[model samples]
Target: MTRAPWMAVIGLVACAAPAERSLTADPGAETTPVRPTHPSGIWPVTPPGADSPDTPDPPGSATNCDPLHLVATDIDETLTTDNDEWDLQIDDPSYDPAMRPDANTLLQGYAARGYTIAYVTARWDFEMSDGRLASEHTVDWLHDHGFPLHGGLVFLAPEPDHDGDEVVEYKSGVLLGLQAEGWALDWAYGNAETDIEAFLLAGFPDDSTFLVGDRAGELEVPGIPNEDAYTAHLAHLASVPDVRCE
Candidate 1:
């Protein structure tokens, strides 16, 4: 697939309150064991240039960018059930994480059908615990568990101050950045009410958005049971024509 020309402008909105937002909670907000440095792995280290923030365009003028059909999903509860009651296990060493049931099947199915996958999580790029960048471990975790990595990219929150409710805006900006880079967000999945807010704020259609776990009904978006949503999503993708970015 041909890379779309990068637009000079991107649009972003201010953060909204939790109740007003579509998605909720920070996936990496909970405490976990911190490694002092990233573990070496076969996957190439994500370069620093890739972590730069996209410039936002003036209000009301942000353009819909990119021709690639993309599926953007959250990492914590939406894809991995590897967390505790509070849902924060990505940084833990003892989590013994496994992909949420059919997540692999669903994502791999999308890849096979030519859809690009985007893992958009609130996990910060800078580590708070040991001062190491978390992106490497995050990628290793995905690769270690066999999640589809070939045609996908991981979007991590660039800041360490996730204590505020900026997650809604942060996630929204990531989607908007992708749009600025010329990628069209076709589908999005998340467990928090804020996920719905971010996706909608970024202009995803209501029917194209899916909420996982119990928070699905909190917003007007359609709900898919956590256990079976992936399998069902794969079935839905069968009808979608393949789109390539390379």
Candidate 2:
């Protein structure tokens, strides 16, 4: 994970609204072996959402109110960049720290409010020379960037390509896997439609659960802050202290 500040890759769409700044992810190296930050922690578990135009997130409100679990984000177009690819380890320390996205900062806002944090992506699982599936390195990178995420998980992508539909289908497996092991989610976030997979599987059924991200297509859940970026979104919602991306 001792590489450069890179970009991301995942296919998603966005509205053609004007933006003050344009930030898109550059795909980075293939997935690597993640050295867990919390060896016993279930971080890789896909991690919630909302408020209103009139009302606001009360001080210490979401802690007892919001889901006490992870926030699932699409790394490529949504969180990092708006591309279909990522760049490999680049020691370019000045690659623009601003481009690194501040999820860890945001999670602290939520965690202070009392939720847990985790990151999940479609970065395929890694394989060893002997064909044995090894752990993924995306989490290591998260730690490298100070994302505050306890664990990270990658999808098992098909050879040809994996689309949003497949993501929608398998997300439940990931959630159940985490929940069965004692993880509970109150909110989720992402900047793409593929992010809907976790929501569909979550089936929270009320505004109590959140689905925040850059944009959510037809998700229609409450507590969801559809934004181009939470870091950017934070500027707008300065009225509240965004809990740690807890």
Steric clashes per prediction: 13, 40
Please give the TM-score that candidate 1 achieves against the real structure.
0.66
My TM-score estimates for the predictions, one after another, are 0.66, 0.51
How displaced is residue 177 in candidate 1, in Å?
1.4
Give the runs in model 1 whose Cα sits over 4 Å from its true position: 1-66, 82-94, 126-133, 163-165, 244-246
1-246 per-residue lDDT for model 1 (tens digits): 211111111112222212111100123432222121111111223222231112342222212223656788888778876335212433453344556777877777776656667777777644425343456556656766667664366666655566435778877876786676667778888988778888999888888899887665668888887666576656776676565423
Model 1 collision count: 13
Q: What does candidate 2's lDDT look like per residue over 50-90, in tens digits?
A: 11112333444322333335444445444454443333322
Q: Lowest-scoring 10 consecutive residues by lDDT in candidate 2?
A: 43-52
